[model samples]
Target: MDTQTLKHLNEAQREALEVAEASRETEWTSPSFVAELFMGKIRTNLIFPYPEQSPEDRQIGDEFMKQLESFLKCNLDPDEVDRTGILPPEIIEGLTRLGCWGMKIPKEYGGLGLSQINYNRAIALVASYCGSTAVWLSAHQSIGVPQPLKLFGTAEQKKKYFPKFAQGAISAFALTEPDVGSDPAKMTCVAVPSADRKTWTINGTKLWCTNGLIADVLVVMAQTPSKIVHGKEKKQITAFIVEKGTPGIQYPHRCDFMGIRAIQNGVIEFKNVVVPAENILWGEGLGLKLALITLNTGRLTLPAACGGMSKQALRISRLWGKEREQWGAPIAQHEAGAVKLSHMAANVFAMEAMTYYASALVDRGGSDIRLEAAMAKLFCSEAAWKIIDDLVQLRGGRGFETASSLRQRGEKGYAVERMMRDSRINRIIEGTTEIQHLFIAREALDYHMKLVGAFINSQSSFSEKWKSFWKCAFFYPKWYLGLWCSFDWMKSYAGYRPLSSEIRFVGKNSKKLSRTIFHLLLKFGPKLESHQMVLARVVEIGTELFAMACSCSKAISLIRNNPSDLSPVELAKIFCKQSQIRIQHYYDALKKNTDPEDRTLSKKVMNQAFSWMEQGIIPDDGAGFQKNSETTVPLEEKRRYSV
Candidate 1:
């Protein structure tokens, strides 16, 4: 499949492919350790003194945060909206008035034209207050019509759409279908071109289209007729900007979820919906690329939301841990509870570091950040889930109750339940955690794939094969030797000011990680993808390494700028120490683990070989298990007597 894909590329397309390949290669050869880390290659470099926000940018962020705070306080009641399962029209209007819709659009389009960091900050601020509002805002600009239009729309198209988008017109991204989630290759939606080629009629149903019910515009992807590529028929997907209320466009049903209830998500159907030729984005057959590019940055929103949720959890946990007493003292005094709080704080610090670093990379704009963005989304979402769960455990009974219910009972309420529900969706949306692991693993093995590709190509001459062999011979030994022997000089290349001993230890292990990855790639070759467990562990190691690097760099920057405050530095050190331990565990598991036996057991179970275990047990009926006692205490009575 890869061979065929590579064979059909034209010069320009091949150049683009080469550019991507070269960029991945540069990560290892260049001085950016973070970039190299994404490729599973750890080279010491000055990649992180932590990016600093310009004063002007800082001021803009401060002003926006201030305005957003006032706006949320005055116009939004998250608890009320959560109960109603709808965002009030007035709140949407308020967001529009606050320029939330235009936050990502450029200034020339009558929008805020905020930098990526500022944009993410804005998302975090709004998300902290209301998940639904954040979804609405992010859906509008992050992956919606505006983003693709900004990236690929013609000047005329921009002129036509930018103004409306700036004026608070809601937009949605419609890519997922009932059958399609991560794989667009399975898309069944069709866009048939008119005989004259002046228009195209789209017919499809998009499932879980966020903001679909309320969107004024939607960017939809559909399978166009196949185009011949190098004499072989190939599937072609196209993206179109379809205006709302277009002929045959209908919202057949509104979808509800476990979380983010205020979002106007639904199934959107386009039956014979005619879109003009000019509506096509970039060009025909570029839909997949456009979608991927949109998502590269679009995924950042999830991490920002994760960061926000973490902050909220940390604050709530700290207060509850101090105030809530157990055994004649604050629960926080207990070792178990104190450990959870510490982990929460450390993970939040790491999450913030990673999210901001990725955002800064986007704002910097010279390098490709597809890997960084995915890692951020993957790590932050999982971290936020664990952190929120800890918060729930910390609050005990109060965390299980809805905020409104607690408020009605005259107790200070925390939205831990709601936040937990909200955090779960982040793992599934944008990309599932499983999907992200696969994506990260694929990317991390780019160099190995290229090397293997050279050897496998049937078209390569004997001389070329010999050269490739020599290249590998030179590269592998040098790479491994560098990792082993370069420890003495690694610190000099460790970017900016000297790192603390703990951080230096992290750097040393990162080199070991890269060497281990290289050995795995050599051992597995093309069959490595089948070993999903090992691939997943490799991704885990890389993610932790990157997180540790970001945390340490951020701490160093904070300490340098504010020497008087060492608390942040300490937190960062703790996070890095924990990350280092995790990295070692993952690497060790990769070397010696029961994953193969686990896979065997899983396969046997799935194949129904465990029937003997269930032989005497009756299958569970549709009805769930009942309590031993028939009578259940009323909520009022329980609340009256519960601790």
Candidate 2:
């Protein structure tokens, strides 16, 4: 699993792997809590303080959220937005007047200049109320031009774009093509420089471009000329600031999806679109790196978004649990209902701690939050969906009904079903859950791979092997020996009163996780990366362990400050105990699982071994299926289309 495994990878995979590895932020400028936990070291200091947002920043968020909440409640009708598949122009105008457009931009640029925490809080609030509205804003800032501009824009680039964003100009990031989702190496979009070398002519089509239908500007990623490095040809992806009215830009089609339907998303086609060389962000050959780093921090939004949505779900569930009656009593009193309610509360608490902690790290600066942010996104999205699902179940048939329908039928319509649909896309956007797991696994094992991977890799040169062998010999033995020794006796969880032992459990099991990883590395050697199930289990254990630490730290911090209330401690304790059970189950499954059988069955299924099982199903061919319309529309027709 080294960056480019040349041994057996085909051209496409090898290139994809190489491009992705090249894009990774390879420096370790600061300690990462999740990164160390995977290495068998619980960097307690990183998580212990809990990274609180400053009072000044919190106040800013509070005031803005107050205004936003009020405006949304009074003016925005989410059900209508969903039903029409259109966010009203008046609602957008209201948001603009509130300066929602500039929430992430700088004050120097005529923007709000809210801290990361505050920006996240705004997103969370928006998401809690309206998923479509949240995307409308988040897409414009999160991975859109404003984000990359803030991160990698040149001074000139910033001067031109920042004010536009401040003036309520919407923006989008265009990276996905019709055939490409996560794999950018296979990207066919090309930007070729002109004879004068002053501008580049780009030709490509971008798919699923959120806000593309109405965005004022876009950050488009396209492959530039290749560069030869160390006797190998390397792909170079360059980011450019492409204005909406650029001559050849076309909105060929609009995209409708299962959720977030009000978002003005669609397919964007570029035909010989020319742009000045000054638009190149962070220089040529750094577009993917820019995207990755932008996403590294930008990805924090969804986690906060998930946390907020889950909070709403919790509220809806609690009311239903108390009011809904069945089985001779209120549902909340039933054993099964009680467990679900408690877990929902606990999980929501953990989600808050996880999301804010990561956002706080972004605001604090000098902290490596790549792992933390991804874990938060991975955990919160999945957790929020479950929370919303449980809300639906608790509401029984009422949950499945649309809020409008419920109102029509004379029932309380809380939008439980809508929430479920909205909650699902979080797991898929930013990155899919499976991709996040693999991304985390790759990063979690980065240190190990750097230290000893060459020693076991068949493709390593003799000298490389010699170097890595020495590195391995000097590192793993001492690391392995230390794992068996308990460091708990030397450390004390002083402020963690009722949950001190749970905090210690995180420390202890971290060692076990590290040992398990080391053993897996030994058993599978270079092929361990192929063992997706094993790595998934290992990642899950590490994630829950991380969750336990965050929950404990946050709960202790809360209870200490509010000594009169111990409910925070109670919630943390419940979450940690449940996390403990899950962690141990994953730990046990590592040694005993049906992964081999699962893989066997998967291959057979892919080979259509079970085609006969489809005999009883509806028997129609996919007659309606069609590829996206091509990018060759005539100029007259294209010009008639509105942006």
Q: lDDT of all predictions, in order shown? A: 0.82, 0.89
Model 1 C-alpha lDDT per residue in residues 1-643, reported as the tens digit of each score:
1442355455544433432332232343323455476433454334456888888998998999899989898888988887789899898888888788999889898888899899899889878878888888888889999889988999999999998988899999999999887666668899999999999999989999999888999999998998776676567788999998899998889998898888999999899999999999999888877887788888998899889988999999999999999898899899989999999999999998888888887787665677878899999999999999999999999999999889889998888889988778998988899878877887777676666566756667788678778878887777778777875554454453445565566566667767777777678765666688898898888788788878888888888899899887788878977887887788788879998899989899999999788888768877897665448777798899989
Per-model TM-score versus the true fold? 0.89, 0.95
Residue pairs with clashing backbones, model 2: none
Off by over 4 Å in 1: 1-32, 38-46, 457-467, 487-490, 493-498, 611-643
- lDDT score for residue 114 of model 2: 91
- lDDT score of model 1? 0.82
Worst 10 residues of 1 by lDDT: 17-26
- Model 2 spans with C-alpha error above 4 angstroms: 4-6, 625-643
